[model samples]
Target: MHNNLHKTKENTSLTTDSEWAITHNNLTSVYRLMGDLSNALSHLQIALEIRKKVLQANHSIVDVSFNNVGIIYHSKGDHKTARINYQEALEIHRKSLSTVHPRSAETYNNIVFVYDLMSDYSNAVSYYQKTLKIQKKSSLSLIHPDLATTNRNMGCTYAALGDYLTILEFFEKGFNIRKTPLPSAHPDFAKTYKNIGSLFNKKK
Candidate 1:
Protein backbone atom coordinates (compact mmCIF):
# COMPACT_ATOMS: atom_id res chain seq x y z
CA MET A 1 0.00 0.00 0.00
CA HIS A 2 2.80 2.40 0.87
CA ASN A 3 4.52 1.28 -2.28
CA ASN A 4 1.43 2.25 -4.28
CA LEU A 5 1.40 5.66 -2.61
CA HIS A 6 5.03 6.23 -3.56
CA LYS A 7 3.83 5.50 -7.10
CA THR A 8 1.24 8.21 -6.64
CA LYS A 9 3.97 10.75 -5.77
CA GLU A 10 5.63 9.71 -9.00
CA ASN A 11 2.88 11.37 -11.01
CA THR A 12 3.67 14.86 -9.84
CA SER A 13 2.03 16.34 -12.93
CA LEU A 14 -1.27 14.62 -11.96
CA THR A 15 -1.15 16.27 -8.60
CA THR A 16 -4.04 17.81 -6.60
CA ASP A 17 -7.08 16.77 -8.61
CA SER A 18 -9.90 14.58 -7.28
CA GLU A 19 -8.39 11.67 -9.24
CA TRP A 20 -5.15 12.11 -7.38
CA ALA A 21 -7.18 12.47 -4.23
CA ILE A 22 -8.78 9.06 -4.82
CA THR A 23 -5.44 7.35 -5.38
CA HIS A 24 -4.07 8.73 -2.19
CA ASN A 25 -7.25 7.84 -0.36
CA ASN A 26 -7.08 4.28 -1.66
CA LEU A 27 -3.48 4.12 -0.59
CA THR A 28 -4.46 5.30 2.86
CA SER A 29 -7.23 2.73 3.18
CA VAL A 30 -5.07 -0.11 1.96
CA TYR A 31 -2.32 0.67 4.44
CA ARG A 32 -4.78 0.72 7.31
CA LEU A 33 -6.25 -2.57 6.12
CA MET A 34 -2.77 -3.96 6.05
CA GLY A 35 -2.27 -2.78 9.65
CA ASP A 36 0.39 -0.25 8.83
CA LEU A 37 -1.27 2.53 10.77
CA SER A 38 1.67 4.93 10.78
CA ASN A 39 1.97 4.65 7.03
CA ALA A 40 -1.78 5.05 6.73
CA LEU A 41 -1.80 8.21 8.81
CA SER A 42 1.13 9.69 6.96
CA HIS A 43 -0.54 9.33 3.58
CA LEU A 44 -3.89 10.29 5.04
CA GLN A 45 -2.38 13.44 6.48
CA ILE A 46 -0.89 14.28 3.14
CA ALA A 47 -4.14 13.51 1.36
CA LEU A 48 -6.14 15.44 3.92
CA GLU A 49 -3.87 18.45 3.49
CA ILE A 50 -4.40 18.24 -0.23
CA ARG A 51 -8.11 17.73 0.23
CA LYS A 52 -8.40 20.82 2.37
CA LYS A 53 -6.51 22.81 -0.26
CA VAL A 54 -8.11 21.41 -3.42
CA LEU A 55 -11.69 20.99 -2.30
CA GLN A 56 -13.72 23.33 -0.18
CA ALA A 57 -13.03 22.55 3.49
CA ASN A 58 -16.67 21.74 4.13
CA HIS A 59 -17.00 19.45 1.14
CA SER A 60 -17.90 15.78 1.62
CA ILE A 61 -14.30 14.86 0.94
CA VAL A 62 -13.33 16.66 4.09
CA ASP A 63 -15.81 14.51 5.95
CA VAL A 64 -14.27 11.43 4.34
CA SER A 65 -10.79 12.48 5.33
CA PHE A 66 -11.93 13.09 8.89
CA ASN A 67 -13.72 9.76 8.89
CA ASN A 68 -10.73 7.82 7.59
CA VAL A 69 -8.44 9.34 10.19
CA GLY A 70 -10.95 8.72 12.94
CA ILE A 71 -11.28 5.08 11.88
CA ILE A 72 -7.53 4.66 12.09
CA TYR A 73 -7.57 5.99 15.64
CA HIS A 74 -10.45 3.70 16.48
CA SER A 75 -8.64 0.65 15.09
CA LYS A 76 -5.55 1.63 17.05
CA GLY A 77 -7.63 1.72 20.25
CA ASP A 78 -6.93 5.39 20.85
CA HIS A 79 -10.33 6.29 22.20
CA LYS A 80 -9.55 9.91 23.06
CA THR A 81 -8.29 10.69 19.60
CA ALA A 82 -11.16 8.72 18.05
CA ARG A 83 -13.68 10.67 20.11
CA ILE A 84 -12.13 14.00 19.15
CA ASN A 85 -11.95 13.12 15.47
CA TYR A 86 -15.53 11.89 15.41
CA GLN A 87 -16.67 15.10 17.06
CA GLU A 88 -14.73 17.02 14.48
CA ALA A 89 -16.43 15.10 11.69
CA LEU A 90 -19.81 15.56 13.36
CA GLU A 91 -19.26 19.28 13.56
CA ILE A 92 -18.33 19.41 9.91
CA HIS A 93 -21.42 17.43 8.96
CA ARG A 94 -23.74 19.50 11.07
CA LYS A 95 -22.40 22.75 9.67
CA SER A 96 -22.34 21.67 6.04
CA LEU A 97 -25.40 19.41 5.78
CA SER A 98 -29.09 19.38 6.55
CA THR A 99 -30.61 18.37 9.89
CA VAL A 100 -31.43 14.81 8.90
CA HIS A 101 -28.66 14.27 6.45
CA PRO A 102 -27.22 10.76 6.07
CA ARG A 103 -23.72 12.09 6.63
CA SER A 104 -24.69 13.50 10.01
CA ALA A 105 -26.19 10.17 10.99
CA GLU A 106 -22.98 8.49 9.86
CA THR A 107 -20.92 10.76 12.07
CA TYR A 108 -23.14 10.11 15.06
CA ASN A 109 -22.87 6.37 14.49
CA ASN A 110 -19.12 6.64 14.14
CA ILE A 111 -18.81 8.33 17.52
CA VAL A 112 -21.12 5.78 19.09
CA PHE A 113 -18.90 2.98 17.78
CA VAL A 114 -15.84 4.46 19.46
CA TYR A 115 -17.75 4.86 22.68
CA ASP A 116 -18.57 1.16 22.56
CA LEU A 117 -14.95 0.27 21.94
CA MET A 118 -13.88 2.47 24.85
CA SER A 119 -16.22 0.47 27.14
CA ASP A 120 -18.38 3.50 27.80
CA TYR A 121 -21.54 1.57 27.06
CA SER A 122 -23.91 4.19 28.45
CA ASN A 123 -22.60 6.89 26.19
CA ALA A 124 -22.54 4.41 23.37
CA VAL A 125 -26.23 3.77 23.83
CA SER A 126 -26.89 7.46 24.09
CA TYR A 127 -25.31 8.18 20.73
CA TYR A 128 -26.85 5.13 19.04
CA GLN A 129 -30.27 6.24 20.21
CA LYS A 130 -29.48 9.68 18.87
CA THR A 131 -28.60 8.15 15.52
CA LEU A 132 -31.81 6.13 15.59
CA LYS A 133 -33.77 9.30 16.23
CA ILE A 134 -32.36 11.03 13.20
CA GLN A 135 -32.56 7.91 11.05
CA LYS A 136 -36.24 7.55 11.83
CA LYS A 137 -36.86 11.13 10.79
CA SER A 138 -34.95 10.89 7.55
CA SER A 139 -36.49 9.93 4.23
CA LEU A 140 -34.00 7.09 4.17
CA SER A 141 -35.10 3.59 4.97
CA LEU A 142 -34.81 2.12 8.46
CA ILE A 143 -32.30 -0.37 7.11
CA HIS A 144 -29.72 2.08 5.96
CA PRO A 145 -26.15 0.95 6.52
CA ASP A 146 -25.56 3.51 9.27
CA LEU A 147 -28.77 2.50 10.99
CA ALA A 148 -27.64 -1.12 10.93
CA THR A 149 -24.27 -0.06 12.33
CA THR A 150 -25.98 1.68 15.22
CA ASN A 151 -28.00 -1.46 15.89
CA ARG A 152 -24.90 -3.64 15.70
CA ASN A 153 -23.14 -1.32 18.10
CA MET A 154 -26.09 -1.64 20.45
CA GLY A 155 -25.72 -5.40 20.27
CA CYS A 156 -22.04 -5.12 20.96
CA THR A 157 -22.79 -2.96 23.99
CA TYR A 158 -25.18 -5.58 25.30
CA ALA A 159 -22.53 -8.22 24.77
CA ALA A 160 -20.08 -6.14 26.76
CA LEU A 161 -22.66 -5.76 29.51
CA GLY A 162 -22.83 -9.56 29.76
CA ASP A 163 -26.50 -9.57 28.90
CA TYR A 164 -26.42 -12.40 26.44
CA LEU A 165 -30.13 -12.43 25.73
CA THR A 166 -30.29 -8.78 24.78
CA ILE A 167 -27.06 -9.19 22.89
CA LEU A 168 -28.62 -11.96 20.85
CA GLU A 169 -31.72 -9.89 20.31
CA PHE A 170 -29.97 -6.76 19.08
CA PHE A 171 -27.47 -8.77 17.12
CA GLU A 172 -30.26 -10.62 15.40
CA LYS A 173 -32.06 -7.41 14.67
CA GLY A 174 -28.91 -5.91 13.25
CA PHE A 175 -28.09 -9.03 11.31
CA ASN A 176 -31.56 -9.28 9.81
CA ILE A 177 -31.39 -5.68 8.66
CA ARG A 178 -28.02 -6.17 7.07
CA LYS A 179 -28.79 -9.49 5.47
CA THR A 180 -30.83 -7.89 2.74
CA PRO A 181 -29.21 -4.49 2.57
CA LEU A 182 -25.70 -5.89 2.84
CA PRO A 183 -24.02 -9.10 1.89
CA SER A 184 -25.32 -12.23 3.57
CA ALA A 185 -21.99 -13.30 5.06
CA HIS A 186 -20.84 -9.92 6.28
CA PRO A 187 -18.10 -9.78 8.90
CA ASP A 188 -20.28 -7.82 11.35
CA PHE A 189 -22.82 -10.59 11.43
CA ALA A 190 -20.00 -13.07 11.75
CA LYS A 191 -18.80 -11.12 14.78
CA THR A 192 -22.20 -11.24 16.44
CA TYR A 193 -22.35 -14.99 15.93
CA LYS A 194 -18.87 -15.37 17.28
CA ASN A 195 -19.79 -13.39 20.37
CA ILE A 196 -22.84 -15.53 20.96
CA GLY A 197 -20.82 -18.70 20.70
CA SER A 198 -18.06 -17.37 22.90
CA LEU A 199 -20.49 -16.41 25.64
CA PHE A 200 -22.09 -19.83 25.66
CA ASN A 201 -18.71 -21.53 25.64
CA LYS A 202 -17.54 -19.60 28.66
CA LYS A 203 -20.72 -20.47 30.55
CA LYS A 204 -20.18 -24.15 29.81
Candidate 2:
Protein backbone atom coordinates (compact mmCIF):
# COMPACT_ATOMS: atom_id res chain seq x y z
CA MET A 1 0.00 0.00 0.00
CA HIS A 2 2.85 2.35 0.78
CA ASN A 3 4.47 1.72 -2.60
CA ASN A 4 1.14 1.99 -4.38
CA LEU A 5 0.47 5.34 -2.73
CA HIS A 6 3.87 6.60 -3.88
CA LYS A 7 3.21 5.38 -7.38
CA THR A 8 0.15 7.61 -7.50
CA LYS A 9 2.53 10.55 -7.18
CA GLU A 10 3.72 9.80 -10.75
CA ASN A 11 0.39 11.14 -11.89
CA THR A 12 0.51 14.46 -10.06
CA SER A 13 -3.05 15.22 -11.03
CA LEU A 14 -4.24 12.06 -9.28
CA THR A 15 -2.76 12.71 -5.86
CA THR A 16 -2.42 15.62 -3.48
CA ASP A 17 0.17 16.27 -0.77
CA SER A 18 -2.52 15.72 1.83
CA GLU A 19 -3.21 12.30 0.33
CA TRP A 20 0.48 11.43 0.48
CA ALA A 21 0.66 12.59 4.09
CA ILE A 22 -2.33 10.48 5.04
CA THR A 23 -0.84 7.46 3.30
CA HIS A 24 2.42 7.91 5.15
CA ASN A 25 0.57 8.22 8.42
CA ASN A 26 -1.31 5.03 7.67
CA LEU A 27 1.92 3.28 6.81
CA THR A 28 3.39 4.53 10.07
CA SER A 29 0.53 2.96 11.97
CA VAL A 30 0.96 -0.33 10.13
CA TYR A 31 4.68 -0.43 10.81
CA ARG A 32 4.16 0.48 14.45
CA LEU A 33 1.62 -2.29 14.82
CA MET A 34 4.11 -4.72 13.34
CA GLY A 35 6.74 -3.65 15.89
CA ASP A 36 8.95 -2.18 13.18
CA LEU A 37 9.76 0.91 15.17
CA SER A 38 12.44 2.22 12.81
CA ASN A 39 10.17 2.11 9.77
CA ALA A 40 7.30 3.53 11.79
CA LEU A 41 9.41 6.45 12.95
CA SER A 42 10.62 7.11 9.40
CA HIS A 43 7.10 7.11 8.00
CA LEU A 44 5.82 9.21 10.87
CA GLN A 45 8.57 11.76 10.34
CA ILE A 46 7.75 11.92 6.66
CA ALA A 47 4.12 12.52 7.47
CA LEU A 48 4.99 15.13 10.07
CA GLU A 49 7.28 17.03 7.69
CA ILE A 50 4.71 16.91 4.91
CA ARG A 51 1.90 18.05 7.17
CA LYS A 52 4.00 20.86 8.61
CA LYS A 53 4.71 22.12 5.13
CA VAL A 54 1.08 21.97 4.03
CA LEU A 55 -0.81 22.60 7.27
CA GLN A 56 -0.75 25.07 10.12
CA ALA A 57 1.63 24.37 13.03
CA ASN A 58 -1.25 23.81 15.40
CA HIS A 59 -3.36 21.68 13.09
CA SER A 60 -4.95 18.65 14.74
CA ILE A 61 -3.29 16.35 12.24
CA VAL A 62 0.07 17.83 13.13
CA ASP A 63 -0.68 17.19 16.77
CA VAL A 64 -1.49 13.58 15.92
CA SER A 65 1.83 13.14 14.18
CA PHE A 66 3.66 14.55 17.17
CA ASN A 67 1.73 12.28 19.51
CA ASN A 68 2.38 9.22 17.37
CA VAL A 69 6.08 9.99 17.25
CA GLY A 70 6.06 10.37 21.02
CA ILE A 71 4.46 6.97 21.40
CA ILE A 72 7.18 5.39 19.30
CA TYR A 73 9.86 7.08 21.34
CA HIS A 74 8.17 5.97 24.51
CA SER A 75 8.11 2.39 23.31
CA LYS A 76 11.78 2.64 22.41
CA GLY A 77 12.59 3.48 26.05
CA ASP A 78 13.76 6.98 25.20
CA HIS A 79 11.68 8.52 27.92
CA LYS A 80 13.22 12.00 27.67
CA THR A 81 12.56 12.35 23.96
CA ALA A 82 9.16 10.80 24.38
CA ARG A 83 8.28 13.31 27.07
CA ILE A 84 9.43 16.21 24.87
CA ASN A 85 7.28 15.07 21.96
CA TYR A 86 4.37 14.40 24.31
CA GLN A 87 4.67 17.90 25.75
CA GLU A 88 4.56 19.38 22.25
CA ALA A 89 1.52 17.30 21.43
CA LEU A 90 -0.09 18.31 24.71
CA GLU A 91 0.50 22.00 24.00
CA ILE A 92 -1.09 21.71 20.57
CA HIS A 93 -4.02 19.73 21.92
CA ARG A 94 -4.59 22.22 24.71
CA LYS A 95 -4.62 25.07 22.22
CA SER A 96 -6.99 23.36 19.82
CA LEU A 97 -9.05 21.01 22.02
CA SER A 98 -11.04 21.12 25.20
CA THR A 99 -9.31 20.06 28.41
CA VAL A 100 -11.70 17.15 28.74
CA HIS A 101 -11.20 16.01 25.17
CA PRO A 102 -10.07 12.42 24.69
CA ARG A 103 -7.03 13.53 22.70
CA SER A 104 -5.88 15.61 25.65
CA ALA A 105 -6.52 12.70 27.95
CA GLU A 106 -4.47 10.47 25.67
CA THR A 107 -1.54 12.84 25.77
CA TYR A 108 -1.81 13.01 29.53
CA ASN A 109 -1.80 9.23 29.65
CA ASN A 110 1.25 9.08 27.43
CA ILE A 111 3.08 11.48 29.72
CA VAL A 112 2.11 9.37 32.68
CA PHE A 113 3.64 6.32 31.05
CA VAL A 114 6.83 8.17 30.31
CA TYR A 115 7.13 9.39 33.88
CA ASP A 116 6.40 5.92 35.15
CA LEU A 117 9.14 4.49 32.99
CA MET A 118 11.51 7.11 34.26
CA SER A 119 10.64 6.11 37.85
CA ASP A 120 9.36 9.58 38.57
CA TYR A 121 6.45 8.33 40.64
CA SER A 122 5.27 11.78 41.66
CA ASN A 123 5.08 13.07 38.11
CA ALA A 124 3.49 9.85 36.94
CA VAL A 125 0.77 10.09 39.55
CA SER A 126 0.16 13.73 38.74
CA TYR A 127 -0.40 13.07 35.04
CA TYR A 128 -2.48 10.00 35.86
CA GLN A 129 -4.71 12.24 37.94
CA LYS A 130 -5.04 14.62 35.01
CA THR A 131 -5.95 11.77 32.74
CA LEU A 132 -8.55 10.51 35.22
CA LYS A 133 -10.02 13.98 35.50
CA ILE A 134 -10.43 14.22 31.76
CA GLN A 135 -11.88 10.73 31.50
CA LYS A 136 -14.38 11.50 34.24
CA LYS A 137 -15.44 14.78 32.66
CA SER A 138 -15.83 13.07 29.31
CA SER A 139 -18.38 10.84 31.05
CA LEU A 140 -16.73 7.59 30.15
CA SER A 141 -18.15 4.61 32.00
CA LEU A 142 -16.11 3.29 34.93
CA ILE A 143 -15.59 0.10 33.01
CA HIS A 144 -14.15 1.88 29.97
CA PRO A 145 -10.98 0.11 28.87
CA ASP A 146 -8.84 3.23 29.05
CA LEU A 147 -10.04 3.98 32.55
CA ALA A 148 -9.32 0.45 33.67
CA THR A 149 -5.87 0.56 32.14
CA THR A 150 -5.12 3.83 33.85
CA ASN A 151 -6.21 2.46 37.17
CA ARG A 152 -3.97 -0.55 36.67
CA ASN A 153 -1.04 1.65 35.73
CA MET A 154 -1.57 3.80 38.80
CA GLY A 155 -1.58 0.70 40.96
CA CYS A 156 1.70 -0.44 39.47
CA THR A 157 3.23 2.95 40.10
CA TYR A 158 2.09 2.87 43.70
CA ALA A 159 3.52 -0.60 44.06
CA ALA A 160 6.83 0.65 42.75
CA LEU A 161 6.80 3.30 45.46
CA GLY A 162 6.16 0.63 48.08
CA ASP A 163 2.78 2.06 48.95
CA TYR A 164 1.11 -1.28 49.51
CA LEU A 165 -2.24 0.04 50.75
CA THR A 166 -2.58 2.55 47.91
CA ILE A 167 -1.57 -0.07 45.40
CA LEU A 168 -4.32 -2.39 46.62
CA GLU A 169 -6.88 0.39 46.32
CA PHE A 170 -6.05 1.20 42.70
CA PHE A 171 -5.62 -2.43 41.71
CA GLU A 172 -9.03 -3.34 43.20
CA LYS A 173 -10.57 -0.38 41.39
CA GLY A 174 -9.15 -1.62 38.08
CA PHE A 175 -10.14 -5.22 38.81
CA ASN A 176 -13.72 -4.31 39.60
CA ILE A 177 -14.03 -2.29 36.41
CA ARG A 178 -12.63 -5.08 34.29
CA LYS A 179 -14.58 -7.84 35.96
CA THR A 180 -17.96 -6.58 34.75
CA PRO A 181 -17.15 -6.02 31.07
CA LEU A 182 -14.53 -8.74 30.64
CA PRO A 183 -15.33 -12.41 30.90
CA SER A 184 -13.83 -14.41 33.72
CA ALA A 185 -11.43 -16.12 31.33
CA HIS A 186 -10.33 -12.97 29.54
CA PRO A 187 -6.64 -12.16 29.84
CA ASP A 188 -7.36 -8.68 31.18
CA PHE A 189 -9.52 -10.01 33.97
CA ALA A 190 -7.00 -12.69 34.83
CA LYS A 191 -4.19 -10.15 34.73
CA THR A 192 -6.03 -7.96 37.20
CA TYR A 193 -6.31 -10.86 39.58
CA LYS A 194 -2.67 -11.71 39.04
CA ASN A 195 -1.71 -8.15 39.85
CA ILE A 196 -3.67 -8.25 43.09
CA GLY A 197 -2.01 -11.51 44.06
CA SER A 198 1.41 -10.10 43.27
CA LEU A 199 0.68 -7.10 45.47
CA PHE A 200 -0.23 -9.36 48.35
CA ASN A 201 2.96 -11.32 47.89
CA LYS A 202 4.91 -8.11 47.95
CA LYS A 203 3.22 -7.03 51.15
CA LYS A 204 4.13 -10.35 52.78
Candidate 3:
Protein backbone atom coordinates (compact mmCIF):
# COMPACT_ATOMS: atom_id res chain seq x y z
CA MET A 1 0.00 0.00 0.00
CA HIS A 2 2.85 2.36 0.80
CA ASN A 3 4.44 1.49 -2.56
CA ASN A 4 1.12 2.18 -4.27
CA LEU A 5 0.85 5.51 -2.48
CA HIS A 6 4.36 6.43 -3.56
CA LYS A 7 3.64 5.45 -7.12
CA THR A 8 0.39 7.43 -7.16
CA LYS A 9 2.10 10.48 -5.76
CA GLU A 10 4.90 10.20 -8.31
CA ASN A 11 2.44 9.97 -11.17
CA THR A 12 0.49 13.06 -10.13
CA SER A 13 1.68 16.45 -11.43
CA LEU A 14 0.45 18.11 -8.21
CA THR A 15 -0.40 16.55 -4.83
CA THR A 16 -3.65 18.53 -4.78
CA ASP A 17 -4.99 16.97 -7.97
CA SER A 18 -8.30 15.07 -7.82
CA GLU A 19 -6.57 11.80 -8.69
CA TRP A 20 -4.23 12.21 -5.74
CA ALA A 21 -7.23 12.90 -3.52
CA ILE A 22 -8.90 9.73 -4.77
CA THR A 23 -5.77 7.71 -4.02
CA HIS A 24 -5.71 9.10 -0.47
CA ASN A 25 -9.38 8.29 -0.06
CA ASN A 26 -8.74 4.72 -1.21
CA LEU A 27 -5.83 4.42 1.21
CA THR A 28 -8.03 5.74 3.99
CA SER A 29 -10.50 2.89 3.41
CA VAL A 30 -7.71 0.30 3.50
CA TYR A 31 -6.21 1.70 6.71
CA ARG A 32 -9.65 1.90 8.31
CA LEU A 33 -10.32 -1.75 7.50
CA MET A 34 -6.92 -2.64 9.00
CA GLY A 35 -7.86 -0.76 12.20
CA ASP A 36 -5.03 1.70 11.76
CA LEU A 37 -7.28 4.65 12.64
CA SER A 38 -4.51 7.21 12.95
CA ASN A 39 -3.32 6.55 9.41
CA ALA A 40 -6.92 6.31 8.22
CA LEU A 41 -7.68 9.75 9.56
CA SER A 42 -4.47 11.18 8.20
CA HIS A 43 -5.22 9.97 4.69
CA LEU A 44 -8.88 11.04 4.84
CA GLN A 45 -7.95 14.52 6.03
CA ILE A 46 -5.59 14.91 3.12
CA ALA A 47 -8.27 13.68 0.74
CA LEU A 48 -10.79 16.09 2.27
CA GLU A 49 -8.38 19.00 2.01
CA ILE A 50 -7.77 18.28 -1.65
CA ARG A 51 -11.49 17.91 -2.32
CA LYS A 52 -12.22 21.22 -0.62
CA LYS A 53 -9.66 22.98 -2.79
CA VAL A 54 -10.87 21.40 -6.02
CA LEU A 55 -14.65 21.26 -5.52
CA GLN A 56 -17.30 23.78 -4.73
CA ALA A 57 -18.62 23.92 -1.16
CA ASN A 58 -21.92 22.26 -2.09
CA HIS A 59 -20.52 19.77 -4.54
CA SER A 60 -21.88 16.25 -4.16
CA ILE A 61 -18.39 14.77 -4.06
CA VAL A 62 -17.32 17.17 -1.33
CA ASP A 63 -20.39 16.07 0.65
CA VAL A 64 -19.28 12.47 0.24
CA SER A 65 -15.78 13.37 1.47
CA PHE A 66 -17.25 15.01 4.58
CA ASN A 67 -19.46 11.98 5.24
CA ASN A 68 -16.52 9.60 4.87
CA VAL A 69 -14.42 11.69 7.26
CA GLY A 70 -17.37 11.69 9.68
CA ILE A 71 -17.53 7.89 9.54
CA ILE A 72 -13.84 7.67 10.41
CA TYR A 73 -14.30 10.04 13.33
CA HIS A 74 -17.29 8.04 14.51
CA SER A 75 -15.19 4.85 14.44
CA LYS A 76 -12.54 6.66 16.50
CA GLY A 77 -15.16 7.50 19.19
CA ASP A 78 -15.22 11.22 18.52
CA HIS A 79 -18.99 11.62 18.41
CA LYS A 80 -18.96 15.42 18.57
CA THR A 81 -16.54 15.75 15.70
CA ALA A 82 -18.42 13.08 13.78
CA ARG A 83 -21.65 15.00 14.20
CA ILE A 84 -19.97 18.19 13.05
CA ASN A 85 -18.74 16.56 9.89
CA TYR A 86 -22.04 14.78 9.32
CA GLN A 87 -23.86 18.07 9.64
CA GLU A 88 -21.54 19.60 7.09
CA ALA A 89 -22.36 16.77 4.73
CA LEU A 90 -26.07 17.19 5.37
CA GLU A 91 -25.90 20.93 4.67
CA ILE A 92 -24.21 20.35 1.36
CA HIS A 93 -26.71 17.68 0.44
CA ARG A 94 -29.56 20.00 1.25
CA LYS A 95 -28.08 22.76 -0.88
CA SER A 96 -27.18 20.62 -3.87
CA LEU A 97 -29.66 17.74 -3.83
CA SER A 98 -33.37 17.30 -3.49
CA THR A 99 -34.87 17.55 -0.01
CA VAL A 100 -35.78 13.85 -0.06
CA HIS A 101 -32.54 12.63 -1.55
CA PRO A 102 -31.11 9.35 -0.26
CA ARG A 103 -27.84 11.11 0.51
CA SER A 104 -29.62 13.49 2.89
CA ALA A 105 -31.34 10.56 4.58
CA GLU A 106 -27.97 8.85 4.95
CA THR A 107 -26.47 11.93 6.53
CA TYR A 108 -29.40 12.20 8.91
CA ASN A 109 -28.90 8.58 9.85
CA ASN A 110 -25.21 9.25 10.55
CA ILE A 111 -26.09 12.17 12.83
CA VAL A 112 -28.65 9.99 14.58
CA PHE A 113 -26.03 7.32 15.13
CA VAL A 114 -23.70 9.81 16.81
CA TYR A 115 -26.55 11.09 18.95
CA ASP A 116 -27.35 7.52 19.94
CA LEU A 117 -23.68 6.95 20.92
CA MET A 118 -23.86 10.10 23.04
CA SER A 119 -27.03 8.79 24.76
CA ASP A 120 -29.02 11.67 23.39
CA TYR A 121 -32.05 9.56 22.67
CA SER A 122 -34.37 12.47 21.99
CA ASN A 123 -32.09 13.95 19.39
CA ALA A 124 -31.54 10.54 17.89
CA VAL A 125 -35.26 10.03 17.57
CA SER A 126 -35.63 13.45 15.97
CA TYR A 127 -33.01 12.77 13.38
CA TYR A 128 -34.33 9.31 12.81
CA GLN A 129 -37.70 10.85 12.09
CA LYS A 130 -36.11 13.06 9.48
CA THR A 131 -34.35 10.06 7.96
CA LEU A 132 -37.60 8.14 7.76
CA LYS A 133 -39.49 11.03 6.26
CA ILE A 134 -37.07 11.33 3.40
CA GLN A 135 -36.75 7.60 2.90
CA LYS A 136 -40.48 7.10 2.82
CA LYS A 137 -40.91 9.83 0.24
CA SER A 138 -38.04 8.68 -1.91
CA SER A 139 -37.97 5.94 -4.52
CA LEU A 140 -36.89 3.19 -2.12
CA SER A 141 -39.18 0.19 -1.98
CA LEU A 142 -41.30 -0.40 1.10
CA ILE A 143 -39.18 -3.39 1.99
CA HIS A 144 -35.81 -1.85 1.25
CA PRO A 145 -33.04 -2.93 3.61
CA ASP A 146 -32.29 0.67 4.47
CA LEU A 147 -35.83 1.20 5.68
CA ALA A 148 -35.68 -1.95 7.76
CA THR A 149 -32.41 -0.85 9.30
CA THR A 150 -33.84 2.57 10.09
CA ASN A 151 -36.92 0.99 11.64
CA ARG A 152 -34.78 -1.26 13.79
CA ASN A 153 -32.69 1.72 14.83
CA MET A 154 -35.82 3.62 15.77
CA GLY A 155 -36.99 0.70 17.86
CA CYS A 156 -33.71 0.67 19.75
CA THR A 157 -33.84 4.40 20.34
CA TYR A 158 -37.45 4.21 21.51
CA ALA A 159 -36.45 1.44 23.88
CA ALA A 160 -33.88 3.75 25.36
CA LEU A 161 -36.54 6.42 25.69
CA GLY A 162 -38.80 3.98 27.58
CA ASP A 163 -41.40 4.05 24.84
CA TYR A 164 -42.03 0.32 24.86
CA LEU A 165 -45.18 0.49 22.72
CA THR A 166 -43.47 2.53 20.04
CA ILE A 167 -40.51 0.20 20.20
CA LEU A 168 -42.75 -2.79 19.57
CA GLU A 169 -44.35 -1.07 16.61
CA PHE A 170 -41.04 -0.19 15.00
CA PHE A 171 -39.57 -3.56 15.82
CA GLU A 172 -42.51 -5.38 14.28
CA LYS A 173 -42.25 -3.24 11.16
CA GLY A 174 -38.56 -3.95 10.87
CA PHE A 175 -38.99 -7.64 11.53
CA ASN A 176 -41.71 -7.92 8.92
CA ILE A 177 -39.60 -6.08 6.40
CA ARG A 178 -36.71 -8.44 6.98
CA LYS A 179 -38.89 -11.52 6.75
CA THR A 180 -39.49 -11.15 3.00
CA PRO A 181 -35.93 -11.30 1.68
CA LEU A 182 -34.02 -12.95 4.53
CA PRO A 183 -34.24 -16.64 5.30
CA SER A 184 -35.52 -17.82 8.68
CA ALA A 185 -32.01 -18.83 9.67
CA HIS A 186 -30.54 -15.43 8.93
CA PRO A 187 -28.74 -13.65 11.76
CA ASP A 188 -30.94 -10.62 11.24
CA PHE A 189 -33.95 -12.64 12.37
CA ALA A 190 -32.09 -13.63 15.49
CA LYS A 191 -31.27 -10.01 16.19
CA THR A 192 -34.87 -8.98 15.73
CA TYR A 193 -36.07 -11.77 18.01
CA LYS A 194 -33.56 -10.80 20.63
CA ASN A 195 -34.63 -7.17 20.45
CA ILE A 196 -38.27 -8.21 20.85
CA GLY A 197 -37.43 -10.50 23.75
CA SER A 198 -35.51 -7.71 25.44
CA LEU A 199 -38.42 -5.37 24.85
CA PHE A 200 -40.80 -7.79 26.55
CA ASN A 201 -38.42 -8.20 29.49
CA LYS A 202 -38.22 -4.44 29.83
CA LYS A 203 -41.98 -4.21 29.73
CA LYS A 204 -42.28 -6.75 32.53
> What digit string (tens of lDDT, one per residue) describes model 3 on residues 78-185?
999999999999889889999999989989999998999999999999999999999899999999989999999999999999999999999999999989987889
Off by over 4 Å in 3: 1-13, 180-190
- Least accurate stretch of 10 residues (summed lDDT) in model 2? 8-17
lDDT per residue as tens, model 1, 19-79: 6767777878788788899888877877887888888878877887888788888888887
- Model 1 lDDT vs. the true structure? 0.77
Give per-residue CA lDDT, model 2, range 1-204, as digits (tens).
667667777567523378788877888889888999999999888889888888889899899889989989988888999899999998998888888999999888889878887889989999998998899889798779888888889999988889999998988888888889866888887788799899888878
Quote the lDDT for 24 in model 1: 75
Q: What is the Cα-based TM-score of model 2?
A: 0.80
Rank by TM-score (best first): 3, 2, 1
Q: Count of backbone clashes for each model?
A: 0, 0, 0
- Which one is best on TM-score? 3
**In model 2, where do residues sit more than 4 Å from their true spots?**
1-16, 26-36, 180-189
Clash pairs detected, candidate 1? none
Error of 1 at 85 (Å): 1.5
What is each predicted model's overall lDDT from 0 to 1? 0.77, 0.86, 0.92
